[model samples]
Target: MEGKRVMAITGVHHAQITIPRGAEEQGRQYYCHLLGLPEIEKPESLKGRGGFWLQVGDRQVHVGTEDGVERSSTKAHLAYHVTDIMAWRQRLQEHGFQILDGVPIPGYERFETRDPFGNRLEFIQPLA
Candidate 1:
């Protein structure tokens, strides 16, 4: 059994983040309008549940609703691979979003920002 094959998993299918109840519109605006992620329809069975889905290239980001005060974590976050890190930084700043510099990682340029609900998000571009 030294070389027995195990279950193979491909890339990520989706990443889910939660927002406070009644904040779905805010989530939609930030993800769809500002981030430019196209909104995807949720399945009929899940439509009764609040929140929506957005397309992220081949993957998806599922924004769900939670019943409680929203609190953001400083450490846990979603990092996305991008083509132009600086351009994204500028775009976010232009939209009145605060950009935070990420700790230096060799061969990678990245920065951090928050969504409307204060969820941490990171964008990274490989250094040439």
Candidate 2:
């Protein structure tokens, strides 16, 4: 116990997902306009770079710009806790986003989808 450092992670401050270079506007349209996430100003020091941030609940989601990576093939993703899953499904579908079913979990009902940039995302709701 003398040399061991105990690490306790309290909560997530933010999660970042990447989109291709120069696709920031499409990212904004899909995430902010279509998905209805509110945009937050990036710090002035970070503003010169491409991409933006979004506000989700009490957390910030950094949407960064990257190039040369295959976004669709990655299994990594962000899971957003949401209410009224059906409404969200309908809303995204109306905007031409496909709803993909995920594997069942014990106490959660969830589905997956891709942003226009092909970043994987999950919308999850707790079951009663």
Candidate 3:
């Protein structure tokens, strides 16, 4: 292995979350209007499937539509890093969304919430 090279891994390019059928508008309202993430266009080949793509900083969150699926917010979730934790928490509360407290993780403040379609999401801010 002296001359072997290991593959260099970079940051996440995108993460995909599923939404139930006919929930596109609700998804847009939450991910775009509330979260302030700009909606991006999907590839021409994939446009037939109903969904939305959103830009989160340098990364992307792809919300895809699935039919006939029961929605449940589980432990598996996507976590986004943010700057102001309290402000985000307030916003969620003001919007009538339930904020689930997260276990204390040193150097980070975090909370969990569910999207309109019951997709679990987490927001975190680094503590100095």
Clashes of each: 0, 0, 0
Best model per TM-score: 2
Clashing pairs in 3: none
Name the candidate that leads on lDDT: 2
lDDT of 1 by residue, 5-111 (tens): 78888778999988887888988888898888899999999988999998998999999988664446557788989987888999999999999999989999999
lDDT of 3 by residue, 1-128 (tens): 48887898777899999898778998899999999999999999998899989888889999999976555626789998998899999999999999999998998999999887888889999997
lDDT of 3: 0.89
* lDDT tens digits by residue: candidate 2, 14-126: 99999998999999998899878999999999998989999999999999999998889999999989999999999989988899999999999999999887889999999
Ranked by TM-score, the better of candidates 1 and 2 is: 2
Each model's lDDT comes to 0.88, 0.93, 0.89
Model 1 residue runs over 4 Å out of place are: 1-6
Candidate 3: clashing residue pairs, number: 0
Each model's TM-score?
0.88, 0.90, 0.89
